[model samples]
Target: MIAPLVSVVVPHYEAPHDLALLLTALELQTHPLDRLEVLVADDGSRDAPEPGPRPYAVRVLRQADEGFRAAAARNLGAASARGEVLCFLDADTVPEPGYVAAVVRAVTAGADLVVGRRRHADLSATAPDALRRWFGGQGPVPREFDEPTWLREAYERTADLADAGDDAYRFVISAVLSTTRRLFEDVGGFEEAFSAYGGEDWEFAHRCWLRGAEFRHVPDAVAWHDGPDFAGRTDDAQARRSRNVEGLTLARFVPGHANRGDQLVWSHPDVVVRLDDTGAAVADVVASVRSVLTGSDAGVWLRDGAALAVLEDPRVHRGEPPASVLGRARYRVDLERPVVLTGATLADLAEVAPVRVGEHLAVRRTRDLHRGGPDPAVLQVPGVTAEPAQDVDLQRRWGHEDHQRRPRFQRSLRTPFVATERPTAAP
Candidate 1:
């Protein structure tokens, strides 16, 4: 495939020196100059940066000073981007020559969300002579520092996150990440509500996961950050406070995770248990529903008027078949009779739920259903029976004209090969 045009977005505050260095690195990227656009997103700098001569196109977007609004600045840059892909970078991070090219390679290989590796260095004390020497490829620049080991291990163990689960969003860092414009637009831009630092990336990654975007980590797309990792920063107390606030902000959006003192629901119900009138009396259906709701706080979709009358809990949501709730809810349990559920069952089902509805359907039984044969969508769950030792409502059907269709994804690990050779600097 041909290389795509990329718009690199740099979020800056009052760091002109760092911003200039990053822009210099961008000018030397190995990717085709005509295929790249540089966008500098300024977050209310007191003294705005002056435009300077650069090989590639540069556009500076400024927003009013309103606390720390990096999220809003990035959103603004994305709104004005005119490229097929958006590559995000912090103003203080300078990329290697092959950074843009490696990112392009990953995207072409079918990754909708790609995170590049960030190598940190103590550049705060470096003079202009040392910086020029490093950029000029004349001699050794500086000593490389440690990166986040947990994040690196995650990518390697999962082979660039081909088998990542819901929690994998925690490893996605926006400081050096890239994704297609269409995918970014579909998820809606970053949550501008994050006025403080941290956690704008994780929320965006979760939204992309919900939209079925492929996430990959490109280690060869190396970038050099000006300082140590966030944990190693000199200001420890402020960092901890910001992290706490950020975690709470994320708990509000992501399901199954919550901070202490929060009244919000911690474990979200994955499936909406549906009870239909299966030739049973309303009283029997209501009793079955009560049994199902023993420990689970899941909402129930009631089709029978009698069942609806008995259960008055807020969790027992009543809706018609194929309601809007079905679209939002991850799973649907259609049963003839209610089964006694322990606390563990609901929690277990939530973990193993198929990523999307209609992808996989788990049912009580799968053999000999009445009328028009068994629904191909239903997958039988063994050893689970209704209370009072009941008959299978939609059971006894398997492998006649139907067999369980397991899901398969396009999974592969990509190893990026970066060129060490550098082009001579323009005079």
Candidate 2:
């Protein structure tokens, strides 16, 4: 079968250090340089755009200062392309060396649109890696390519188009995605009408799926994303998020969610914290956020997973898995014997005792970071881990690695803190 020419199109705006990393990776793709073209679309940055040259043979193009966002930039690159597959990548992401060949394989093996995985590359902000712990959240998003056997098969078996909105949380980021030129034009090209802060990809993909394009995750094709630098602050950007929520987009795309409260903590951009847990108390918290999350689009217990789907937040939805152990939806505290999950590291502990969790004065009571999600059950009982030695194995993600026989954590359980002790309290 004749292979299709692939275009590795990148959209850059005042970000070269990150862009260079992306280009460097493109240079290493297993696919021959002859079969691939790397093009950079300079979105009219204030400084002069890099006139990319040899080594990578990258084509550099520019557009007027219309502020159309990465979407517009990709459109411009596609307009000048000679490839059949348009591999759209954000400027800050570095594709894995095998990316091109993987895309080619998946597409030829039959996926019309293949989405790759994104791992967090750098923490450009102070304590970014730390703060990520404080909130019990992950970073750089967890792009659902986590386990792709299902993703690959789904795409190949049916030509039916898939969309992020269909799974909203997992389909989260538009970070590393590949699609055909046909899928591009039929979607009407990123809705130039949806100005600013970029939800255009989701909106555009929604349209394409509506038009008959298939989407899936390509596990082996990966990218390293320099996670968003929110500058240690949340501001007007929160307001701008409404721009994407304005049109009937939410009405049609998001089910079970309502307008956010006048202002809600943890309701930051690109990241979402949707509460799909309809358990008794879970529904109460859902009512609390009644202002923001609404609709028939909500996931039911039997349909959605067991407890809280962290993938709900647009940020987390797009695979920005919480950064530190504290950030992980699955409990990522980094060290042992202490409660500061954020500052903890590989040398530190991933879980702590109930007393340690409660002893921390910052918390007043226990509440799951997942809100209407699963409960971590932190409580101030000393016997669970010692004296009254109740044995609970620290759960580990299924890995191909063997187990080392050292108690991951050993301490007297004392105070009650977040994620400790599920309530048997009457609803």
Steric collisions counted per model: 6, 58
Candidate topping lDDT = 1
Residues 247-342, candidate 1, lDDT per residue (tens digit)? 877665554433224223333343467765555665555555655655543556666556566657666655564423332233457754444432
Residue-level lDDT of model 2, residues 127-234, one tens digit each, is 323323422344343322123344344544443234343333235346788888887765456655444654666656544443445566776777766763232224
TM-scores vs. true structure, each candidate: 0.71, 0.48
Candidate 1, which ten residues in sequence have the lowest lDDT sum? 364-373
Alpha carbon lDDT at 310, candidate 2: 28
Model 1 lDDT at residue 338: 45
Best by TM-score: 1
How far out, in Å, is residue 214 in model 1? 1.3
Cand. 1 TM to true fold = 0.71
lDDT of 1 at 281: 61
